[model samples]
Target: MVSHDPAPADPLSLHGVVPPTVTAFHDDESLDEETTAAHARFVVDRGVHGVFPLGTNGEFPLLSDDERDRVVEAVVDEVGGEVPVIAGVGAPSTHRTIARAEHAASVGADGIVVVTPYYYPLDGRAALDHYRAVADAVSLPLYIYHIPSKTGNELSLSTLSELAAIDAVAGVKDSSKNVPWLAQAIDGHPELTFLAGSDSLVFTGLEIGCSGAVSAVANAFPELVVDCYEAYADGDEERARELQSTMFEVRDAFKAGGAYMSGVKTALRLREFDAGPLRSPLRLKDEEATAELRDRLESIDDLEW
Candidate 1:
């Protein structure tokens, strides 16, 4: 088990809001490197702590391995040390996942976000071993991604504890909306950093000792999410709650349109980012729904950076 080291003297000890960027695509559905780099620069310039590409929000599963490598390279090059870049390396197979991790490291990513294996719902022991294998395979710090809803596997407390024992597994992006589980994970391991994976719970997670959040919504509204974290860290609980409530409203609006990913793309398009629609089977919202989302997002006067 890897133990959590103190915040590194180097810059990659990610705290505060790190936005999982949405992958932009051209009209023909090819990778839009220009728009993607602009989006990365836009988020970092907006005062986000870091930029995470190729996560679920980035529609990573739909991209080929070479495409993933190209996109990550583009982000790292564009960011150019202005902010840390944590590349997502969650392939369905452990071997491929490890390769992606190595690729991310080679491309100069500061860290990697690895999801639990999705195809076969591995038991606790298998899950533990999978993470251990990946951690051992890479020298870069790893943040385990626990989004059971998508992966169909959960990272139990014992699994987290075991992973925490490893020197390379620095933290987790706990996407399970279960508050009790989050509390137990945080309480059980004081050394590991717990980053909230869901945007709606960023403040609640922070209040309970989460180091930060990897928010999808931050791709559209970076300042709003950053404000929530800053408010809480400044000891202004009232301001934090207010900002969190506002975020919840935005999330609800997202749900009203569709799932958060589709809504996020819609919002970005509304903002003129040209982040193309979700891939097949993840259909875009209807025109009426999109207009409604635009109104809801636009109605919030302070959403801009």
Candidate 2:
């Protein structure tokens, strides 16, 4: 097996609330590196344990190679030492994914999250080979990004078992929303760190032994998730559930109009941190819908945003 010295703290030990941050863009739909880095600082300051740039929340599929690279560099430059920066380097092909992974490493990302190759169906052996190739190319810890709904490729437990044997394969960020699958994966490989990738499952994941979460809701309201995590870690399950309830309210408000992604950026704006617009083919809510969202969020008494 290939091995390399772990970066900073062992990334395998990565825990607590980590936000898959938004890719801030200017009004003209240009990459706003300044606000992008600023958003990372925002979450880190709010007590997020780590930051993940260029994931689904980041609109990774919408960016060019250069734009993605710059986002990673900008984030690392802003908060490299404060918390681990796990950059999303997944692409649709193994060769391209390895190239992006290499760039993330070169620019100082502590680790990389490689989603399974999307748009094409593949079996377990091919999936295993793809990850092995990427792991071989990068020394940083590699996290499998499993969101089958978006990617259309679900990882089998047998493949996950084989992946656990690769020294460079550190963990998984599972957005599969399959609680049983996640539970089995955690039971099946105690060596691999498991992060709940959905905001809905943060508390449930902790209860089931996940080390932490990669929360999209955290991009806007990190403190809520952070408090939920701390409460659980501190052995206050009741407190954690209370906070998770508030989080669910916040999540509902954000998803109120089915523009959940837009809702996250909108919530950020309401809190006075303009992450600006999302990239093209994706959009902000229309005026009336946005206003309704604002009213709905403000009604949540426990949250300020």
Report the number of clashing residue pairs per model: 8, 0
State model 2's lDDT: 0.88
Can you write out model 2's per-residue Cα lDDT over 241-262, one digit (the tens) per residue?
A: 8888888888888886657898
Error of 2 at 247 (Å): 1.4
TM-score of model 1 (CA atoms): 0.94
**The 10-residue segment with the lowest total lDDT in model 1:** 1-10
Please, what are the lDDT tens digits per residue for candidate 1 over residues 1-305? 12222244323677889899878887678888778888998888888988889988888999989889988998999995887788999877889999999999998998988998897878888888888898898898888889899899988788788888878887888888999999888878777777888987888888777878899889988889989888887778888888888888788778775776788888777877777767777766789999899788777765662
In candidate 1, the residue pairs with backbone N, CA or C atoms under 3 Å apart (3 or more residues apart, or in different chains) clash, namely 1-165, 1-166, 2-164, 2-165, 2-166, 2-167, 3-165, 3-166
| TM-scores for the candidates | 0.94, 0.96
State the lDDT at 66 in candidate 2: 94
lDDT (CA) for every model shown? 0.83, 0.88
